[model samples]
Target: MTGYERYLPILLLVGSNIFMTFAWYGHLKYRSAPILTVIVVSWGIAFFEYILMVPANRIGATVYSAPQLKGMQEVITLLVFAGFSTWYLDQPLKWNHWAGFALIIVAAWLIFLE
Candidate 1:
């Protein structure tokens, strides 16, 4: 596959993870929904998550090593959740969070190190 084709799966993975995060955490804002109901809703959303995520891994495996795929996924997941938590949850992005995120960046760099 070409460069764009290879990246398509990664983009889809990102979108799926964003949807999953919202489905899981966004329910916290809804007081009317029962715990069971929220869980069920999240489960429903998570089905689509797997649909996209599995394909991403398969496609990524063709071009990237296992550790590289994990490193990239972890980095993107952290970045996405950081923004989601800060903007949607009305939570502050503390120094600790930034530090932790920086560590993850280091981990990714190490994973790809020559």
Candidate 2:
């Protein structure tokens, strides 16, 4: 595979995670909005997430194992959520959160081991 092809899955994953994170958590900013309204909006956002995520997995499967894809996705999710929580939600991450995330990184490393 070319360099771009090899990295396409990761790029797609990052895009999907951005949409997914916003779909899952962006509604927090509108807490006073009607629950039904937020739910519908979240679903709309999630539709785009699925669009990217499904193709990402399909493309990634050609190069990476299933477990490796899952591990990468989880790590990406955590990283995206961490930034979203901090910048968008104004929630500060504590030391324990960092420690927990570090453990997950270790798990990802193990998953990619030959």
Candidate 3:
């Protein structure tokens, strides 16, 4: 695969994760908002997540196995979530969080070895 084809899916996944992280957790900041309103807004934001995620997996399939793609997505999610929680939500990740994430990275690495 060309460099663009190889990397585009990862980049797309990253962007999608950003939207997803916001969709799921962005509401935490506005706890007083009606539950129905939060759900609707989160769904609206999730629409964009699907828009990117579907294509990311489709294109990614050309270069990586399904397991690899899923592993990549999981690792990406953690990386993105770590930043989102800390920067956007003002929730700093503790050492154990990093340790768990590191273990997940190891798992992803193992998946890629298959």
Clashing pairs in 1: none
lDDT per residue as tens, model 1, 59-92: 8888788898888888888888888998898886
1-114, model 2: which lDDT tens digit per residue?
876657899999999999999999999988999999999999999999999999999989988999999999999999999999999999979999999999999999999999
CA error at residue 10 for candidate 1, angstroms = 2.1
TM-score of structure candidate 2 = 0.96
| TM-score against native, each model | 0.88, 0.96, 0.97
**What is the Cα-based lDDT of residue 77 in candidate 3?**
98
Candidate 1 accuracy as TM-score: 0.88
Better of 1 and 2 by lDDT: 2
Measured by lDDT, the strongest candidate is: 3
Tens digit per residue, CA lDDT, model 3, 21-113 = 999999999999999999999999999999999999999999999999999999999999999999989999999999999999999999988
State which candidate, 1 or 3, has the greater lDDT: 3
Best-first order by TM-score? 3, 2, 1
Return whichever of 2 and 3 wins on lDDT.
3
